[model samples]
Target chain A: MTELTEIKKQDLLYQGKAKEMYTTNDPDILWVHYMDQVTALNGKKKVQMKDKGKTNCAISARLFTELREQGIVSHFIEQLSPTDQLVQKVQIIPLETVVRNYASGSFVKRYQTEYLQKFDQPVIEFFYKSDELDDPFLNDDDALALGAATREQMAQIRQLALKANQHLRQIFAKMNVLLVDFKLEFGLTAAGDVILADELSPDNCRLVDLDTKQSLDKDVFRKGLGEMVPVYEEILQRLLKEGER
Target chain B: MTELTEIKKQDLLYQGKAKEMYTTNDPDILWVHYMDQVTALNGKKKVQMKDKGKTNCAISARLFTELREQGIVSHFIEQLSPTDQLVQKVQIIPLETVVRNYASGSFVKRYQTEYLQKFDQPVIEFFYKSDELDDPFLNDDDALALGAATREQMAQIRQLALKANQHLRQIFAKMNVLLVDFKLEFGLTAAGDVILADELSPDNCRLVDLDTKQSLDKDVFRKGLGEMVPVYEEILQRLLKEGER
Candidate 1:
């Protein structure tokens, strides 16, 4: 691995619930530091798990690289450290794009249905990201009325999300994990091209063991079921083993 | 209104929260009996207003006539009585189509915004009409995933909803009333045609005075502002005058 002795991390650009951003020496890149901290219910619940950041970084790096190989573009540049990465700096859109391959989480609650209702196709939802208002779910009209995204951008976002769902679900299926649902965020580069920009790991995805239906993602912590570090580590190990093949 | 001396109301087919349905002697027609009961928040808040049935029937008949004149087909046949109407019976779709010309009521609560946010274009939303589950908002994907409506049917529903919004907004504007938003329902005929059903009145619409911004619809009862009879009467009077012209 190359040492990051030349690049410097300057002023803190922003701090999120589970990550920190810093200005970097390269004008086109930003330093992303994944934190061990995790939050749920819009920060009502919080916890710190050892090695969480390292595990997530590893998974995100591998997935983003794999997605690129699959013809889906992202903002990932390269991993600088175990918990830090240098990514192409883009203006993050104020939306959380969600894709549900199966009925779970808020989908079940909203529809008042039983768990894991398999959908014939993936359902894409866009939520306006405002923690103050608990991130209200939005449709295309709501998005346009609020000036969150244009019609063309929304169409692109939906297409990209469905593509990612197909690729990621297959990848997890190979490891005997069911990629139930996940949230995504997109950003616009300086040239106004929308590309995937957020981390893709257990923190943002719901993964269930195919045989046991046990939660292997953040749902464990969110539901107060068990330790998240071991499950996250398990995910990382699975991905790494696949990479070796 | 035509007298119903020859027609006979047969078996009670169904009873909704605000209306009752009865089979008619014509076999192809159904008798819609509007009730005075007004419900909101999924029937959690309700009250019986005197003359509500008669007023709503008059308003719905006039509006339906106006919409038909504007080239929108519906099931409305003719007014049989002040509180009853003859309509074509069809299998009702389990979805409520909503068109919003301005942000109000649940829209404001969903987005956490103040009321009366005018839209340059009307927004259309679909809700699965289930009283047990409070009729959750749905998109085209959700509707298809739940087997609620086919893609072709949803496309038609959306187009018809937008068309209805355009026609209704213009009609209300002519009466010095701002048609904020309204709900609609569509049903398939025995011959498999989707036509508009359900009453359009103060209960199902949010109408504001163009000059005073006064609550002229069910918000009068829902928000405990004042009596609703006078405002409904005002609406019916205005429409009747427009009809005479």
Candidate 2:
């Protein structure tokens, strides 16, 4: 990938709750630094922890590589360091695509459904990603009305997201983790192809241990279950076993 | 329409917050009695007002007839009395289909947009009709996951709802009322054709006068504006002027 050793991280492009994005010497590349931080409630509550960034960095890189091997296009290029990576820069769509295999998080809160209730079919939802608007849950029509994406783009995102889900569930299942649900951010390439973007980590997924039923994701931070990074590392350790197949 | 004189209302089928349904002699027909009661917050608030039912009955019948003339198939058959009508009994789909020309009500609450921001195009949303679940807002996928509607039925519902909105907006415009938004319900006929069901009235529509921008619908009761019945009567008077055209 584009002489990875020669790439230089430049100016900071963005600083999100858990990651920092930087422009790179290569115009099409972005440098992402996973931070030793975690957040819940849309960054209302945040904390710093050791090894969080490295664990996430390894997991995201491995997963993106695995997904790419399965022919799912993403922005991820390659991992540069324990907590840094290079990815293709894309115009981020302002909609968050969520795929749910079982009920958890907001799904349980909104519908009062039983926790871990397996859906007969995966349920997909969209949310306008505006912190000012608290990322209000929306439908495809709302996405179009907001100019977040077009009908064809949404259809494309749906196809890509479902494919990602099928592959991801298999990966997690091999780790003995139930992928309850996950949030995805899509972006348009310069040529206008919708592709998966943003970091894939426990920060955006609700994962549960199949046997212990313990949460191995950010819910540890959100629900105050206990130490957070250890669980994420558990995920990283498991993924290392299920590493880039 | 069956002979209104010979039809007999038998067993009470269902009692809703604002209306009651009864089995009729004709197997294909159901008797609807619009109650004087008005409830908000999903029936958590309740009140009875004089002429509320009759005004709604007249308005719903007139609008339904107008839509039928425009070739939009609906369950409405004929008016029976000031507060009653005959409607074809189809299995009601448990989803609230909402169409919005301008944002108001929950749209404002959810996204915090301006109270009456006109949309580039009508925005459609669906809410799962469940009191036990507080009628959670859902997308097409969620509806399918809930077994609320089939894919084909939802597509047909969207088409019919949009057409109804087109004609309803025109009817309201003639009366100088801004058709901000409204909710609809659809049912499946025995033949499995999706058709519009449920009464259309100020109770389900947000209407505002063009000149004064005054609320002419249930917001009177909801926002404690003033006497709710007189405002509904004002709408009836205006619709009567735009009658049968």
Candidate 3:
């Protein structure tokens, strides 16, 4: 498990790959220490994949900034350093929320049809919070039956996801990239407000070139079909170019 | 797009490329006609194979029967014929509920560390309900945020997913196969009951021979490794042989 040596006198709150999370004894804030590592094929294969952490951190910071500019609530308080982030730690939600603008990957596998030729309305899916299960999809009734959320809260989350989707679509379109789809996580504040939490990086998002279908995110690694860091760097350059414009 | 004529419906449904879905005029019954067309990815390219539907339907029916015998609630009502299934009509849950007994897929991609290696615990994930979007993962909070599920519903769905995991593990273990992971869907009745729904076929599962690690499910297509139908058929023969004991 990755350890947070920078934060003092706090018990390790939780540890996940790529980051070590800790509480500051204040109970209101959480500190995440990002590490430089990369994995693929369900950990059956691993490589140092140098500078991945920094690249992901920079990408996440840029995205969070863009998302905040668009009025979406996010946990990113500040970039403590290139390798760390200070965030308003809310009750981290367990689900992996996704919003999609185009078709690809498992969608093609599941339908086994040519539906990907046309863009469909953005859709939302819920998976139970278990990684060993490889993040299966869940339906509204299934979520309700699980008792993890109330009807009102589920409604609020959906609205926020859609709003986030709209904002992301607009932002990516401006960059001449398709937002194809992306995963999101959320948490509850002490006051019970659901806010977006988690890193919004190239790793969790699938950004494709509008014309070439060139992928600019971590799907490159999972599919084992393309180079990783260069693609990340290329996307960063694109974002920077867009910013300059 | 594959259609079934009345005369060929039985064999075609049992052995077709896609299932034919029909809604009863009464609105209380749903009909699913299975087909015979099969496709597989033997290595890097997808190939249209033959007689996959029959192999999958037989295997799915057998597994559903085994699950039901073990007191697991599933969408399978009964095998109507060699090619069709008679199931209680319910609102098909749009989520593909997956439970994994082993580490695999995107779980490794996200964490990028070995501490989470092949978790002994099952992990659940929710993917959004859009083939056009590539079935991207969504977290519980995101699912709630998207109005796809309530907190309470998610909890229930998680419990059900875990239970199903246990059931599948037990059955597969007895047959000397590792139930690596499987996808599931749930549905809601008009009376607000959540029940397991969707086809439990080789297409939706990854079965590995306990000794050989030879795949017995649809991953043969995803990986593009060839001779998938034969692999499925081999698993069926094995399961049948095991049942005789």
Docking class of 2: medium
Which docking category, incorrect, acceptable, medium or high, applies to candidate 1? medium
The TM-scores, one per candidate, come to: 0.97, 0.96, 0.52
What ranges in model 1 sit over 4 Å off? A1-6, B1-6
TM-score of 3: 0.52
Candidate 3 lDDT at B221 equals 67
Q: Residues B56-124, candidate 1: write the lDDT tens digits.
A: 999999889988998888999999889999998888888898898899987888887769989877888
Q: How do these models rank on DockQ, best leading? A: 2, 1, 3
Error of 3 at B171 (Å): 31
* Weakest lDDT window of 10 consecutive positions for candidate 1 chain B: B1-10
RMSD of 2: 1.9
The local lDDT score (0 to 100) that residue A232 gets in candidate 1 is 95
Q: State residue A74's C-alpha deviation in candidate 2, in Å.
A: 1.2
As for candidate 3, its interface RMSD to one decimal place is 9.6
List, residue by residue over A95-206, the lDDT tens digit for candidate 3: 7777766656655555443533444457666665666755656544435544456567777787888988887777788888888778888889888999888888777788
lDDT of 3 by residue, B10-90 (tens): 222222235666553334444566666554321234345567667777777887787778766666655666766655567
Displacement of the residue B25 alpha carbon in candidate 1, Å: 3.4
Error of 3 at B217 (Å): 26
Query: Tens digits of per-residue lDDT for model 1 on A35-139?
Result: 999999999998888899999999999999999999999999889999999888888888899899889998899887679888888998889988887999888
lDDT minimum window of 10 residues, candidate 3 chain A: A1-10
